[model samples]
Target: MHDPLQYEGRKVVVTGTASGMGEATAQILVDLGAQVTALDIKETSVDVETALTIDLRDPASIDASVAQIEGPVDAVFSCAGLPGPPFGELDTMLVNFVGARHFIEALIPQIVEGGSVGCISSAGALGWQEQLPILMELFARETFEDQKAWLEANQETWGWSGYLWSKYAIDAWVGWRGADLIEKGIRLNCINPGPTDTAMMPAFHELAGKEVIDSAIGPIGRYSTAIEQAWPLVMLNSTRMSYVCGEVLWTDGGFIGANSTGKQGGFGEL
Candidate 1:
């Protein structure tokens, strides 16, 4: 078992702490004796030592956060993102991909040496793993406007392809960010979670239906609790995982292993 005492006296900035896995991550960190700064939207209720409300979609809000939040931070745990409304996957893509990229670019300098940064992607993100070329093209463009333009130009061709594509970008970032962050003494990584019993569960079900939700293959038999999924993140953000970088730690049980064809993974497959 990993020692929770490993994080004593570290400072962490956690996004999406308003609820769900974000809340679970923050609670665990605080309990471990880390000074955690939480971030969510304008509407959040979790009372912590420090909580920053951010309109993650708006670059200005993100900038304000970096400007105001105390630094040099030991780690950044970006957990604020959305599945958005049913049929509004574009919003999901924007919040998850574009907004998250801005967060990294703006905050990289603040990460303390031996510090780590990680985010929570979903098992669903695996669907876009093969489109490296297109995803790279999207990453090349920096501003939200560029990403929005790419989405607009391709919306007709892609439909709600944004959500999956955004996550694809996230996974790509994890794989590609070590060069930039490693030099600063900070490591970057992420986790891909399978379906969980969060408020977002209803939104995902509403968008893709129960079959999609139930299809999140896991050896655990049923969906995981938010706290169950929060452990890997807690370790990833601390110095305890000092040598680990540019990796996506899958917290999705056997979900990815069960993704035979993504549509139908026979009863058994290794």
Candidate 2:
């Protein structure tokens, strides 16, 4: 059978692989015959070529992990994140966007031409477009410290929902930086997954009542599985998706479409 995804023997890096979508993505990549390097703050059970511990909230940790990774990577699946609450808002933003961005930027030189980067954003970032002005301002700061400082200084603006704002930043960064990466023969894209059933689900439920969480579900009528979310992310970074760059694939079972059309209710309403 032809390997349409072209992952066989490919060198790929997957973050947040200790559990949830990251673990699912790593397992799937391994099964597809890719050489997977799994990374997370905790140990991952996934059978990969390498498993490294990484703290996405710290630039030093991210840099250390990158140094350990053998380069000429074919793809990167950045799935690490925090659900907020137990973790502080700033810490959440650091792991979700700031640190993640720093890690990816560090790997850019090592990524082979045509390599692709796939990130996991959130459906909660529905109105990200409206927040672009401020997001751009945050992006203007080049260094990790500078961006972190900017985020720290602008807390009041996005502190209300670090998860939402971080997801918003992810969506924006994919489009904003993707344009530049593609010129180097690399592609960057992300998936804004709706509610997914993962270890992190309970945290979200605790933060924003179960009723509200369920309301975000579209016609799908249920939360997505880790693998369900992982598939689109894997596909987004596949060689086949060569032309698809700087795109946000809403892996929400029609939630975005339905919400946009006013057919889906509850979440994303004006």
Candidate 1's TM-score reads 0.90
Task: List where candidate 1 sits over 4 angstroms from the true fold.
Answer: 1-5, 260-270
Find the candidate with the highest lDDT and give its number: 2
lDDT of 1: 0.78
Whole-model alpha-carbon lDDT for candidate 2: 0.93
Model 1: per-residue lDDT, tens digit, 27-64? 88888878888888854465567888887778888899
In order of appearance, the predictions have TM-scores of 0.90, 0.98
Q: What lDDT would each prediction earn against the true structure?
A: 0.78, 0.93
lDDT of 2 at 156: 96
Q: Give the range of the ten consecutive residues with the poorest summed lDDT in model 1.
A: 261-270
> What C-alpha RMSD separates each model from the true structure?
3.1, 1.2
lDDT of 1 at 25: 90
